[model samples]
Target chain A: MILPGDLSKIRSLEEVFLIRFRLDKKSKVPLLLVVFGVMLILFAILNIVLGSVRISLHDLVRVLLRQGENAVYDKVVWDIRLPRTLAAILGGAALAVSGLLLQIFFRNPIVDPYVLGVSSGATLIVAILMLTGVVLEMGTIPPYLLSVGAFAGALAVVILIVAVSGRVKQVVTLLVIGLMIGYVCGAGTTILEALAEKENLHNFVLWTMGSFSGFGWEQVSVLAVAGGVLLVIAYLLCKPLNALLLGEDYARSMGVNIKSLRVVLVLIASTLTALVTAFAGPVAFIGLAAPHIARLTLGTSDNRALIPATILLGAVITNFCDLLARILFAPVELPISAISSLIGAPIVIVLLMKRRTSL
Target chain B: MNVMQTKELSVGYDGRTVVADINLEALKGQFICLLGPNGSGKSTILRCLAGLLAPLHGSVFLKDNLLYQMDPGDLSRTMAVVLTERLSPGLITVFEITAMGRYPYTDFFGHLSREDEEKTWEALRLVGARDLAERYFNELSDGERQKVLIARALVQEPEVIILDEPTTYLDVKHRLEVMEILRELSRKKGITVILSLHEIDIALKSCEIVLLVKNGKILASGPPEEILSEEMVAEVYGIESAHFSSCLGGIEMSNSGGAQVFVLAGAGSGAPVYRLLNKYGFSIITGVIHENDIDYYVGRALGGAVVGEQPFEEISLSNIDQAASLGRQAEYIVDAGYPIGSLNRRNVELARRLMAQDKVIYSLRSRQEFEALYGVDGNKPVYCPNLGALAQRLSRRKK
Candidate 1:
């Protein structure tokens, strides 16, 4: 039994591991948040300045203050590069938090937006719209209609998966079912692409490859707003998510209204996935890898600390990956998915190998 | 008034009832054990009472409020549960897991208030798991994990707590320790506890009320004294060949081996001998024992044909006559060497009766020892030093 007097000794022992340079043990999470926050800003700036057209950092700063003389450089920084960099950061954070939420809701580390087929469902709808010429870039179809279609398609799969989850209690079985659904959706997408015109097929294939290039302010604002609102909802669910880590039965016993909570969690996760997939065209691996990186770095599973930590790590990593995707081939840029998978997959494999028995 | 009551509660899945027509009333501080065989719906009934499953046909009331109708927030504060299923603790610490019990009372963010933290630590200490607070939950042993789960439930500070087979995976020491903790929790803190258990002996000893369930129906509900009969256990568990001894708080298999032996025993010396003979599948008949003798309990529990006498009385004429007939029919006689006095001197006479037949008589005392102690030199009995030596001789004789 622990005496009241020994409580302090135990607490101090814990504090010994928590103490860092000038920070007390309690301030560690905030300190990590500040470090990540500042690093994220720096990486976002580096993404903007280090592209093929070398815009000096001074010129970029002057353009940002709206006092620059070079209109072409200002247009390059503001119209093209800034939107793509912001898209990478916002989309990355959204996907990462989305992954964290699904992992918590499903109580499986392997679960992510991509693994649960939400991203594939959204991609399928967007592909159908893009390949069939119904969502043409011309004035005939409002482009935002594809975003709406993606959201609806993602939500449909979310509802279906949620229904199946209620009937199926096993996590691995649900994951397998999700993979099957993704395969069916992928097959349909392939059939639609086969029937499309050659020019339209190029657009569909490019979207399928997943890139943050050509992200405009309109797309950025939508992702920012949707991602911001959904992340806040995910944050509000942190406590119940912690309870859910116990299991669905225990969560319900704790008054967590499992049915409604499951729906809400899937909705938030689907929205985050749909918003990113709609604009960035299904960037892969960020959702699966970012939350894991956060948990490993923080050495804790407290979702209150993990959620924001994941958001920052995801943004910085996505920005870094996006920068490499643009500069690696110089004139011939690689797909954002290719870079994220190349970088993220190895980190995930390392984590799994390090904790071979658990994952 | 009862703190919790269920009226004709039927619980199941997919509209099919598993355990039906259940009625129960539990007082504020009662400890109830749901005793049944595997697949008897003990866990289903427990989950139903904890409000996880909606009763198929009837109502559960908590302090006169309909359980299903009560708000979840209100229900969570009033009741907690410890299920038999093990949880994946992941990277969480024991303290964090215990603090989850305060979910209903915490703010929207689930931040632990100072009082909540104190309560969590207190609960951990109550279950003697405070030293495990900083350790990762998955790193603990099964017994420590069970204690941590109990502590988690205790942190809820609920009026009632439900557990499902909480002692299944624990060792004997841990099983008793967990039960002892629950017993103390209910008695001291006035927290009503309802748990399903497979250990009949432990349940009979720890629980105040027993609900015997079988074939998806409750057979009986009352204190273990009235309801935990050998017949009731046989019917409930469908063990036709096993006998339960509520006095001993244990169960014994039926005597199948036909080897017969008459034991000369009294006081407490014959108890272990009776058990060993029963264990070896021997059909045993023991003679001339006082009703108050401790051996009488063990002997009767193993279904031995007991030849009895009244307490403080000498061996009666009728008892010796019965012993002689039974002893003559036996292959061997066991003289357990119970102390002889003036009142019970007739026990040695019964031993002499068996020796006169030239039977292989086994005594815990040796031949010269028995003759010097009780018998005459001319009518001596073959005697072994102890039960082990006697058993060895008996096995050799069988070979």
Candidate 2:
């Protein structure tokens, strides 16, 4: 029997909320989210203002606001910097969220789209189109054909992995299979590169190296719409994803449909990876490291918090890296992958060392 | 009322039947255990019942609805499972883990309502883990993790909870605590607690019904008292040397080809002697013990040759003569210093007769105390103060 004192001791909803949130000291999450928001905005503005030409913030704002615009500055910002900046943000966020999804799906912290052959699959198909001149032979290259090819290739790999996942219960075996698929796709890309013409080879090599430059408004819009919709879908999956962290048996026991969740997880992760790779040329490190950064910063594994935090961190990190890529070498314009790895690899290493017990 | 019933259920993987023709019913509030050795398909049966795996043939019914036909959400609301897999979900608090049990009740985003929070806390309190609610799940010990997992299942407010070796990794205290909590959950909350267990002693003591699973089938299913016979247990587990005593509710390993030692003991005095003898590889012959004494049970469990008498009866001459004859074959005699009461006053006379016959009797009392009890002046038995001293003396004699 509960005494009157015990009934009074039963926590109120406010206290329960405090106790629950305070367990991870998750009040830090909101503060960190606000900080990340500011950083994202700062990096986005910096990306717009600090290109090779060095457009001032005032002129950049004017071009953004469509007031008091100089033609050269307007053209540079509107035609080049604006789309590239937005594409970097979207691509980074998409890759990070995709990485988070696959990490959870595989129940392995290090797994991401790049490691799982998804980006390689997209790259291989894009290489075929670019180097083999298969599409150039048809007169004009359709605008969205690369995106379609990347999506199909990425989806094919994801479907194969999903089918193999159904048969293989061990995560290590599945990871090995993914790595083998990556090698095969890489081999295919190498053979195509060897057979291509010199001019085609340079373009294909640069594409393979990865960049956030030269994104058009059309591609940016596609990235924005498709990536936004998939991110929302991924957010909607937070409950099941959280349940799944306890493993499939516990998740299924909690009423999650494991088969469908697996399919959906792979589908979203691959599509996001493919979408970004189609535009950004299989950018590395961001997909593999951004989720780890989010998890480390937030100090929680609840996907509801993780998904948004990862998206914001991914965008911020990618925009900062892209800014560095442009300004670090000045007019030389180093590949974004080099700059990303230079920064992302150290952060991931530190995170691994600090959290040897967990991701 | 029956909460779950399986009809001719044949469970297995890839259409290969593991445990076939299984018909089991889980009544509301009943605590049932599936007792078996390793690889006995107990987990397979539990998986099928929990709807985690499909039955190869036949159907499972939850209440009146077909188990497979029921929606996953509806099924989960009625049943929860605590599996054996060790969860290492990084950075998840115990509260968060427990609150995940509210999945069937929560909204699309899994925001815990006030009622859900209350239930989660209540569940934590029920498992005596309210203090660990704020702690990270990965930091907990195995026993603490187990309590939290049970709390997670309890938060579901399930009608039936299925577990796979829930206490397998726990210490003795935690094992009893977990069993007690499960028993309370069944008795107080009317939740049917079904679990597969390797602990036969715990199963016999706590479970209302036990199913002896072996070789892809349940060999027997009934109340533990009715079905857990020594022969049945030995047969099911394929154990030849160890004996399962219904009276003692434990298994005792038997050692063959050891030195014979006759022990004069009664009123729970001979149990430790019998165990120590068995441990030292000495065959035991304990005598003059009443049928209802604990020594009778322990001695019998250890395969000791027990010379017995009827409960509450005087030590009969025939029983004492039988013990004397058995004592004659033994190399040594141990007089467990039991009190000379009215019903067992004849045991002192038996000890005196053995001493007069030149039999060396190891006594657990002082020489004066043995002489006063046996009413003898000259003839004396070797005196040892405790079981430790007696064991030393026996080991010395063996050397």
Candidate 3:
């Protein structure tokens, strides 16, 4: 019979480790958020200044203030680097928030937009538009139409996955089903690629490789509006998301309308993934890795802290990865997905190995 | 007043009824338990009552309000539940988890108000988990985790709290502590506590009302003492050999048929000996025990032949003669060394007569004490000090 007085005397080995590390304290969240905020600013600045043309910080600041003398440098800063930087920030934050939502919804650490095939569904629709050019016969296809198509395809796949999730309770089984859906979409994209004209096929292949190279203000605005609204919705859902950590039955008992929460979570998550995939052509790993980074750095599972921290970390890491993609191969400009996978995959593996509880 | 009541309720999954025709009422401050064997739909009944599952027929009323018709937020504020599901929310603190019970009351951001925080701490203190407030939820032991879960339910401050097998994974000490906490909550705080449990003895001692569920229906419902008859338990649990002794508040396994041992025991000295002998497959015949003695209850529960006497009556000649005839057929005799009061003094004479028949006797008393007490000089019984020594001697003889 352990009395209340005896509980403090009983120091388990796990408690000893927790005390030594001081990892479970809620006070650490604000400090970690400040650190992430600084990192995000540094990375955002580096992304703008260290592009292929190598604009200096003074010239970049002068261009941003609209007082630059050099036309080429000003154009490079305002038209090229600035738009790509904003795109990376918005897209990364959206994908990360999407991944966090899916992870919590499925109650699995490995779930994300890419793993659940939301990005592939969007990719398939965009591939059909780019490779086939069926609508090009009428005129040049509007980018808005592509975004709409991608949203439709992504929503379709999300609806399908949600339907299957209801029937299949096992997380691993649902993951496999998502992988199978991705394969079918990939096969469709491959068929279009095999039959396309060479010039169109080349552009389609580059798009499939996933880069933030040609992001213009038009794409940036779409990402900002859609991703910004979805992020606010995600933030508003923090309370129920925290309740869901105990799982669905407990969450429902606590008065969360689970069916509607499911719809809202999948809608926001898939739309965010579709929006990013529509403009940036399916960037990888940021969605899957950023939430885990937030969890590890914050050392807590409270969604109230994790949501904003994940947004900052995602924006910073994606911008950093995009900068690496531009600089690593110099004139060649490697795919952003390649750099993101190289850095993000190893970090995710190490983080998962270190924390064995949340699987 | 009745805090929660159900009428003609049937619960199941996907339209298939698991249990039907359940009518139950829980009054304020009443501790109610659903007692049954495994797979008897105890959890189904509880889930239905908690509004997690819809009943197939009839309605559940919470203070004149329909349970199924109430809003989820209102239901949550009025009732709380502790389920058997294991939680592993990563890196959440105990205080944070317990404060989750205020979910219904918290605003859109779920920020804890001063009152919410105070209630959270109060619930933690009530469950004796305040010391663990700073610790991670996953780092705590199973018992501590259960306490934290209960604290979470308590923080809801519901009029009624329901639990589905809250003590399933706990050890004996934690089981008692958790039950005591629930018992106190109902008794002192006036919260109607409802739970399903497999521990019949604990339910019998602690619960004010018990619903015995079997197959696909509730077999009976009433106070545990009035409804939990020996036959009812045997029938409900499908026991063929073991006996549930209401007086002993536990079940005793049937004794195996083996070598006969006549034990001269009275009072409570023979209970442990009866258990040890039953464990070793010895058919026990204990004698001259007054009807009200604790040994008589244990001996009879173990299916041993106990020679009985009226309460507070002297051990009579007829009882001695019957015991001596029974002892003659035994391969060995045991003197349990019960206190020699005037009422049970004939038990010693029976032992002396059995010893004179040249029977081997294992006596707990020493040789001098046995001879002085029996007033015998030639025939003697072997002195074994304790039950362990006697067991060793008995096993050797059996081999």
Best by DockQ: 3
Residues forming the 10-long window of minimal summed lDDT in candidate 1 chain A: A17-26
When candidate 1 is compared with the true two-chain complex, its DockQ is 0.38
Candidate 3 per-residue C-alpha lDDT over B64-152 given as tens digits, one digit per residue, 9 for 90 to 100:
89999999999999999999989878778899999999999999999999999999999999989999888779878888999999999
> DockQ: which is higher, 1 or 2?
2
Candidate 1 stretches with Cα past 4 Å from truth are: A1-25, A69-72, A129-149, A159-180, A190-206, A349-359, B261-264, B328-345, B352-399
Clashes of 1: 0
State the C-alpha RMSD over the true interface residues for candidate 1, after superposing those residues.
3.2
Worst 10 residues of 3 chain B by lDDT: B374-383
Here the TM-score of candidate 3's chain B is: 0.96
Per model, how many backbone clashes are there?
0, 0, 0
lDDT of 2 by residue, A32-106 (tens): 888998999999999988866788877777877889448988888889988999999999999999999888887
For residues A1-359, what per-residue lDDT tens digits would candidate 3 score against the true structure?
99866787565655677676664455678888999899989999999888568888888889999999999998888899889999999999999999998888878877777777877788788778877867768555676776677777777788888777756544457778888999999889889888888977787777777878757998899789879999999999999999999888788889998777876877788878877887777888898899998897677889999999999989999999999999888988998989998999998788777873554
Q: What is the TM-score of chain A alone in each candidate?
A: 0.86, 0.87, 0.87
The residue pairs found clashing in candidate 3 are none
Candidate lDDT (C-alpha), each: 0.84, 0.87, 0.87
Q: In candidate 1, which residue pairs clash?
A: none
Worst 10 residues of 1 chain B by lDDT: B373-382
Candidate number that wins on lDDT, 1 or 3 = 3
TM-score of 2: 0.90
List each candidate's DockQ score: 0.38, 0.51, 0.56
